[model samples]
Target: MSDSSGMPMTFTTGQMTSLYSLAWTPSTTGGYAGTCIFLIVLAALSRLLLAYRHLIEQKWHDRAMNRRYIMVSGQNETDRERRIIGGGGEKAEEAVLTSKGLDERVKVVRSARSNVQGIPWRLSTDLPRAGLFTLNAGLAYLLMLAVMTLNVGYFLSVLAGLFVGELAVGRYAGIDDNHH
Candidate 1:
């Protein structure tokens, strides 16, 4: 079996193989091993990035909860009464437990937001999260491309990398599969 270029269209354990691009072909045993190692490291790094993203999310959640507490405590009796009346009493209490209180709390959080070196607080937190997401996405796509090569060695390398990555960082990333 062959393609238009006459290259065999089948999986092989041959040393000569192209990965991601023709220029990346590893034509020697050492080169192939290095490529496998690179893929392993790339997979591991993606997991590490995922763990960092989880940590950032946890941190932001904590901060948001703290801000909610501050808003609740900072409100005067009149403000609380007005909120209960304006939002409806039982609904207001539920709102305090949930999302509806966000609007009223914004003013207080804004002060803390502004105190952060003149940078908009949302931007400061959002940019890193967005950047990490973009990077993780790119890495994931690259790994997918590596798997698409159909070479048994490369495929096994990817699986091994994922296994090693999960063993190293899955717990910290909160990727609990067995409820443990």
Candidate 2:
């Protein structure tokens, strides 16, 4: 079916109300709940994409640094690496040396790495705090949808809840810049 917004309607406020007693739809509601969910998913994806961009750039920079180091300082570090890998061509000794050298390199790699995933990034970094702030602002939005869906008489409370819930979620996600 088509909605007032000129979009193909799915399960709508009316359809939903028909299914559940004491529910109704109005022109003001405007299918906000479903759209809000989509928006949340979009926000999550945006965060992931941004994290990936940073990680990819970091990897590229690291590769360049490593190559430059190998070309410019290879000989200088050779004496130290002798006991680690391929040092003096003693196969076993060289293997040990190589492993040890890699261990040191691993530290550098770790230092350059960052938490790109959501759970960690949200919990430990500023990203979630920022998200939280946005979510807070969204609270009124959700309440309006839910209220409009429920056809509850208290419009103001419904609006407040909607905004509060949205803002709370954003704050909890720690995506708000003002939060920190």
lDDT values of the candidates? 0.68, 0.36
Number of colliding residue pairs in each model: 0, 35
The segments of candidate 1 whose C-alpha lies over 4 angstroms from its true place after superposition are 2-10, 68-121, 176-180
RMSD of 1: 10.5
lDDT of 1 by residue, 1-180 (tens): 668984657876777779988899998899999999998888888888787788887787555444422245566766653221222344343334445534444222222342335333587788887898899889888988887677778878888887788789888885642211
lDDT of 2: 0.36
What is the Cα-based TM-score of model 1? 0.65
**Candidate 2 Cα misplacement greater than 4 A, ranges:** 1-30, 68-180
Residue 110, model 2, lDDT: 18
Q: Which residue pairs in candidate 1 have backbone atoms (N, alpha carbon, C) closer than 3 angstroms, thus clashing? A: none
Q: After superposition, how far is residue 83 of candidate 1 from its true place, in Å?
A: 15
Worst 10 residues of 2 by lDDT: 103-112
lDDT of 2 by residue, 1-180 (tens): 666854334434342232122343223444435434433544444343334434544554444333211121234555432211111333332222232453322111112233334112223335554564455446434443444444223333344433554454443332332311
| lDDT comparing candidate 1 with the true structure | 0.68
